[model samples]
Target: MSPTIRSLVIPVTDLAAAKAVYTALLGAPHTDESYYVGYNVDGFEVSLNPSGDTAGPVAFADVDDLDAARESLLAAGATEQSAPRKVAPEARVCVLADGDGNPIGLRGR
Candidate 1:
């Protein structure tokens, strides 16, 4: 299945500060949470993560099948950074690295 880039996960040192910045930029209040802060702009989702581990933003593709998408990307020269993991009851996500070592995330529900 063709994937669509519909989400972006940004690692921030301070969740509150990031939320304020993103809220002002997107002109919408973010869904605040202890683990993640999310903003819905139009149809795209922007998430602020407080893990402080990511080097940069990770763009997430919306896929119909998480396993299939991971397999396809791996076969197409991407290296799996992480296996599929459940984020919610019905949502799963995986992380991979492209040829240039950029992190890419895949999300399926």
Candidate 2:
């Protein structure tokens, strides 16, 4: 299944600072939680993750079938960084690394 990027996640050392900056920049309110802070700007989802790596921002793609998408990416020279894990009752996510070690995220419901 083809996947479309739907979310952009940014790792931050300070959640509050990041949230404030993003909120002002996006001019949108955010859902504040202990682990994550999220905002919907225009048609894009922007999130601040406290537990994410500092390497760079990760773009999460929505796929119809998570498993199939993971397999397809792996076969295309991507390495699995994390296995599928449930984020919500009916939603799951996974992470993969390209040959250059850039992280990519996949989400499915």
Candidate 3:
């Protein structure tokens, strides 16, 4: 926790082509799917998603309490771009936007 960015999701247009490039750079992915390709590098997650809103990669800050952390961001004038959604068992992620429209990703339970 401690506001660390341990997860980052990169948006790619071509899944297969991106996979090949990422695999060459980061080795093989641990989780591969039609929509997602995830690589684990010493506990840091580097994932690829073709459906991300931004053209650039999104770095997700790992938080201890998702609801509280999200609320705090909203209270500080951040806009909620995406609601809390579960990605896995006890794992959830959401997208928020700052005043300048920069996407802020949060991932945790």
**Which numbered prediction scores highest in TM-score against the true structure?**
3
TM-score of 2: 0.90
Which residue pairs collide in model 1, if any?
A: none
Model 3 quality (TM-score): 0.92
RMSD of each: 1.5, 1.5, 1.3
TM-score of each: 0.89, 0.90, 0.92
**Candidate 2 least-lDDT 10 residues:** 23-32
**Local distance difference test scores for all models:** 0.87, 0.87, 0.91
Q: Considering TM-score, which of the candidate structures 2 and 3 is the better prediction for this target?
A: 3
Cα distance off (Å), candidate 3, residue 59: 0.5
In terms of lDDT, which candidate is strongest?
3
Where does model 2 exceed 4 Å of error? none
* Local accuracy of candidate 3 as per-residue lDDT tens digits, 12-99: 9888989999999999999999988999999999999978667588899989999999999999999988899998998999999999
Per model, state how many residue pairs clash: 0, 0, 0
In what order do the candidates fall by lDDT, top score first? 3, 2, 1
Cα lDDT of model 1 by residue, 45-106, tens digit: 88888986668899999899889888888999999877888988999998999999999899
**Candidate 1 at 93: error in angstroms?**
0.7
Q: Which residue ranges in model 1 land beyond 4 Å of their true spot? A: none
Give the range where candidate 1 is weakest over 10 consecutive residues by summed lDDT.
Answer: 27-36
